[model samples]
Target: MANHRAAWTDERAEQVIGELLRVGVILSVVVILIGAVFYFLHHPAARANYRTFHSEPDDLRSIARIAAGAVKLRPREFIQFGLLLLLFTPVARVAFSVFAFAAERDRTYVIVTLIVLGILISSIVGHI
Candidate 1:
């Protein structure tokens, strides 16, 4: 009876861990897709505009002016850039954790995934 109960508990734990891993994979995919859309929509245009105005900047004065203009970004633009980078960090962490898990098949990855998810969720909720 004791052996049967222990086996059932072990099986249940495995099922729960599997479900968590699936959720982590799905969340990571969604985060990456959203980040890609945002980067294409936002950063590429700004970079193009900056390139158009600055060109090669062959001298010190031109470089100074470009630097000054870059530093003069609007508050909203800064926030958008920060948010884009912030969004990528967790996705990257999850990708690394997945790789770590696949390479070693270690249980430590389950804890790492949970920590990353907790941090991401807290940041999203606290910021809003």
Candidate 2:
């Protein structure tokens, strides 16, 4: 256990976090694309009505509802969930930074990274 912990160096942590970001983005894209395909499949010949402005459905007004819609494979909600995932990718990196710093016994960095993580979360949650 100690040997494995020692092997988890800064470079390794960075590489893992980088991969997290890349995979997150790729997964978001795949989700969005899948939703788009589903949307088109259901509305192959549908055309946009430009006569009046339309708002998003009431069911997509909250994260819980969006998640529920996504679980049910609703197209717009699924795409919105994908976009929400993309938005949180960087936030996840910052959160991992706190863990990495804690593992290294770097209190200063852990504190700073925690502040950054808090701000990121608040900024996202405040408007919601």
Q: Which one wins on TM-score?
A: 2
- Model 2 TM-score (2 dp): 0.85
Q: Which prediction has the highest lDDT against the true structure? A: 2
lDDT of 2 by residue, 31-57 (tens): 999999999998899998888868777
Per-candidate TM-scores read: 0.32, 0.85
lDDT at 101 for candidate 1? 55
Q: Report the CA-based lDDT of candidate 1 relative to the real structure.
A: 0.50
Q: Cα miss at 76, model 1 (Å)? A: 14
Q: Can you write out model 1's per-residue Cα lDDT over 8-124, one digit (the tens) per residue?
A: 343455565566566656665554465456556655555434535654333222323333432454333333434444455546556555544544555686678767767766664
Error of model 2, residue 34, in angstroms: 0.3
Q: Which segments of model 1 are wrong by more than 4 Å?
A: 1-8, 45-128
Worst 10 residues of 2 by lDDT: 1-10
Check candidate 2 and list the clashing pairs: none
